[model samples]
Target: MSRDGSPPAATQGPASTGFIPGNKIFNRRDFVRERFGAAAWDAVLALLSQEDQAQVASVDPGAWYDVHLVERLISAACQQLKLDDGLLMEMGRFDADRELSTVYRWFLRLIRPSFAIRHMNLYWRRSHDTGTWRSWQNGPEVSAELRDWAVSNRAMCITLLGYLGRTLELFGGKLASLEHTECRSEGHATCIFRTHLELPADEPRPGRRPTRADISSLARELAHSPNREALVEALVTLLRFQFGCSWVEVWVTGQEDRMQLMGVSGERGPGDQRRFVLEVAGRAVGRLELELPRGPGQRGVDEVLAELMPWVSIALETARVDRSEPHHVEESELARRLRRAREIGQLTPRQLEVLELVARGKTNKEIAAVLGRSEGTVEVHVTNLLRKYGASNRAGLVAMFWGEL
Candidate 1:
C-alpha cells in the first residue's frame, strides 16, 4: 500500500518494469501524449521545457511563461515520490553517521540513476558534518534506471531542482552547481552525478561572552528598556542578521499604533517589498516589511517571514495583554489627594477634573499640564479612577460621572 493506503499499481516493482533506456522511451512525444493527456503534456512542456524558448525568446519580459507550471510539476513529483520513493529521502539516513563519499556513492547508485543528470558532483559544507573537507573525484555514468526515470520523469527532476532552488533561496542560499561524470576502477565502471546548493556564510558569531555577569547585566538592561521599541528594533536586527536583508520594518497596530524600521544603514535604492503578516489567535495584528532586491531573495524572504511569524505573534499577544494591565508607578500626593477627595467627600475629584477638561475638549497632554503632571501619569490617573468607578476612556468617564454630578 502507498501512503494513501491504496494498492500499488503506480508503485510497480522495479524488476517488473523492464528498464528500456528510460529516457529514450519517455522522450518520445507519444509517451508524453499517452501518460499525460496531450493537452496537459503540451501545457507543462510549454511552461517548463525548452519547447517554447526559441519562439518566446523575443517575447516581452512581462509576458514570461507562468512560473507556477514549474511549481505544479514539482508538487506532482514530490507527491509521486512520497507515494513511491523520494530521491533525497533515499540518498541517506538522516541520523546515521554515514560517510559523505558513501552517501555520494549511494546517491549515484540509487537517486542519480533515477534522474536525467547530465553532469553532477556533490560539494558539502567545509567541516561541520565531519570536521573535514571532502572533494569530488568522479564523473557521471548513465544507467538504465536513470535513463528510464529521466525519460518518464525528466520534468519532475527539473521541477524538483527549481523547487529546491527556490526553497534554498528562501534560506539565503541558491542552487550553485551541477555535474555529471564517468568513473572506472579495477574493471568496474559507473556514472556519477551530483547537485549542490550553496548557502551564504552565517552571520559572524557575537563577540560578547555569555557569562553570568553578562546575563545579569542584560537582564537589568531588558528590565529598564522600553519594551515595544526595544522589541521592534531587535526584531529588525534579527531579520537582517539572520536573513541578510538590508532593510526591515514592523508595523504594529493596537490601542496604540506604531511603525519601526531598522537596518537602514544609509541612503539606499528601493528593494523588493514583501509583507509578512503576523497573526495572534488567528487575527492579524501587525505586519513586517522587507525592502530588498527581489531576484533570488524571494525564497529567503519567505523563510524569514516563516521564522519571524511566531515571534511577532507572541509580541503582539503580549502587547494586547499588557495594554489591559495597569502600570506600576510610585504613588504620588496628587493621586492620593484625588483618591481622598473621592472617598471622604463622596466625590470623584480626578473624575471631575478629567470630565471638565474633556467638556472643554482638552487633549490628554493638555489636561496633564493643567494638572501639573506627565502625560503618562495623567493617563494612569484617568485609567485608575475610571476603572474604580466602572467607566471607559476620558470620554466615557465624562458621560457617566458628568451625568451623576
Candidate 2:
C-alpha cells in the first residue's frame, strides 16, 4: 500500500522490494546522460565490472533491482573519473527536479513551506517505503528523522541532503538550510535532518539595539550628506557595515507604502514582513524595513538608534521634498528654511534638542526633565526658537521646526 491507500504503483518500490523506486534508477540514467554526455555515461558504466555493467545496461526502470548495484556503480564512477560523492548529490537533485510529475511539481510550488514540509512523510513514502519518516515542522523550521533505513551506502546521505534541500527551494524557500545532525553509518540510531528557513521578522523588536560605534558613525556620516539621496545611501551603508549582510530601506511614514531609501548588500526574497519604527521626537515618523540576509541579527542596535534618531530626523527633514509629502514642500524648501533660520542666528545641537521636545508638546519643565536641563534653560531655548521664527508662542515655534515657516 502507498500513501494514497491503493496498492503501490508497479514502479513504486515497496518496503519488501529492498530497492529504491525504479524511477530513481531512471533518474540516475538521465542524470549521467545529461550531466556527463551520452558517451561519458557509457564510460562510467565501462568502469564497472562486466557483470555489473550488463545488469545496469539491461536495467528496467519499472522493475525492482538490487540496492547494492547503486553502491557499486557510484564507487566505479568516482574512482575512474577522479570524482567524488558529489555526483550522487547532483543525481539526487536531478531526480527531485525531473521525477515529480509536471502537475504535481507545480502543485508543490504553489503551496506554503510549512504545509508541504509537515506532510513530507506522505511525499517520502511515494519514493521509498523501507524507512519510517518522523517529521516536525514549526513555522519556517522543519526537522525530519529517518530511523531504521539504510541504503547500504554512506555517500547516499549527501544525496539525500541535496534532495531535501532542493525540495525546500521548490516550495518557495530562498535562504533555507538543511543539515544532517546524526547519521546511521556513524553509529547513530537514526538519520536526523535539521532544516531552517531564514524568514524575515514579522514585526519590529522594540528597543532592538545597535552598537555605540554605529550610532556615532551614523551621526558623522549624516552630518556630511550633501543631498537627500546621499543621506539615505549613508544610512543603508551603515546597516550593511553593522550586519555584514543586509537589505535595508527607509520607507515613507504615511499611509502610502512608497519607498524612499533602500540598499541591498545581498540577495533578497519576495516577502519581508518586518519593520522597525524609525522615530524622531518619540513619534514613528517612518519605518526601517529590511530584507534580512541569511543569519541572526547582531547584538545591541536600539541604544545606537536612540542616539542616532535625532540626526536621522534632521536628515530626513531635509529630504521631505517628494510629491508624496502632504505638505508639498518644494525640493529646495529645507535649504530655504535653513537660510531663513540662520538669519535669526545659527542654532546649536542643544537648541535643536530643545526644539524636538517642543514639537512633542512638552512644557519647559517637562522638556527640562527629559533633557536633564533646568526649566529656565529650557524656557530660553523655546524663547530663542520663537524669536528666530517670529512666532507668537510654542505652537508656532513647533510649526517652524516642522518646516511650516
Candidate 3:
C-alpha cells in the first residue's frame, strides 16, 4: 500500500489501470511537456499503445499518473531526444539532489513517514568516509510497478542509481561506485545497492586553530545580538563558516515531546547528520547539528562548540527570563517612588514625555494618540526606557523610576 493507504499498482501490465497521481510526477510531466512541446509529447505517447496514449492524454495536472507511465514517458522522451542515458542520469542526479537540498528538506518525511526518524538517525550515525556509505531500498515494497520494471527493463535502474548516488553526494561525499548487490527480480528479498566513496588522500594537513582575535570577534558579534533568535542565527552562521559544513541546524525541545527547529544555516539535511548538545548549568537546552565533508579540517569542531555553548546558554536564559512576568508591585506605589527618585534627567525630551504617559498607566496606542505619534514610535521610546533603566517590562520600568524617586 502507498502512504495514502491506496493499494499498490500491479507491476506487470499496462500502467493505465494502476497509475496514481503525485506532485513529483505531475511537476515532471508538465516540465517535460513544456520543454519538448506538444508534438514531441504526442510522439512519445504514440510510442505506447492506443489505450496507453489515451490514458496519457487524459492525465491532468492534479491527477496521478501510473508509476509505469511516468517511467516510460521519461524513457521515451530521452530516446526521442537522442539523449545519452549516462547524461540523462547525471542530469537527474544534479536536478534531484539540488531540489532535495534546497526546497525539500523533508523529502523522506513524505515518502517514509513511519521510518522518518529512524532513517534520519541512521544517516547521522553513518560515517561519510570515502567508501563508507551504503544503503538499500526494497523495490517491491516501494511499489509493485517499480518491482515490475526491475524484473523487465532492468536497464531503467540507471535512474535509480543516479538518484541514490546524488543523495549520497549531498552528504559531502563523492560516489566512487554503486553496484546492485541484490535484486527482487533475481529472487532476492529486496533490492540492494552498495555504494563506495572515493577516499581523501592521506596527507599531513595543517590544523586551523582559532586565533585569539577570531574568538574575540565572534564573541563581540554574538554579544551584540539584540534578541535570542538573532543570537542563535548568528551562532549558526558563524559555525557554518568556521567549520565549512554543508548545513547546520539548532533544535530545541518543545512541549509534548516535540522538537522545534530554532534556526538553520545552509540547506537542511535529511537526518541529524551530526549533533551536539547545548547545555546550560548541565541541563540540556537544545542540539546543534551539522553536515560536513570528509577531511582533516573539521577536527576543531568540538573545540568551537565548547567555546560557543557558554554564549548560547546565556542567550537562551536571557530569552526565557524576558518572556516571564516581571516582579509584581502596586502601580501607584511605583509611580509615587518614581516621583521621589527624580531620575528624569536620564530621559530625552521625547522619552520623558513617553515615560510620563507610561507612568500614567497609558497603553502604547493611547500614548501614541495623546502624543500625536505612531504607535511604533511610542514602542521604541518604551523599549529605550526599559533598556536604559535595566528593566524587564513596563512595570519594572515604572518601579525603577519610582524607586529612585
lDDT leader: 2
TM-scores across all candidates?
Answer: 0.23, 0.43, 0.34
Local distance difference test scores for all models? 0.39, 0.58, 0.51
Candidate 1 regions off by >4 Å? 1-226, 256-270, 295-297, 319-405
Cα error, candidate 1, residue 31 (Å): 66
Best by TM-score: 2
Q: Tell how far residue 290 is off in model 2, in angstroms.
A: 41
Clash counts per candidate, in order, are 25, 7, 10
Instruction: Output the worst ten-in-a-row residue range by lDDT, candidate 3.
Output: 124-133
Question: If the candidates were sorted by their lDDT against the true structure, best first, what order would they fall in?
Answer: 2, 3, 1
For 1-405, candidate 2 gives per-residue lDDT tens digits of: 111222211121223335665667678778877877888778877766677678777887777666656655655555445444456667778878876655445444333355445556656766675677778877667788887664634556667777887776665556456677778766778898887865332111122224575455446445544445445544654554443333455654433434332322222455332466665567555566664444344234444555676777666655554313443222234334443454455766466556645765667876676555799988888898888778998877767766654
lDDT of 3 by residue, 235-292 (tens): 6545554455557666654454245566543544343367777666786656777776
Clashes in model 2: which pairs? 208-302, 209-300, 209-301, 209-302, 210-300, 210-301, 210-302
TM-score, predicted candidate 3 vs. hidden true structure: 0.34
Candidate with better TM-score, 2 vs 3? 2
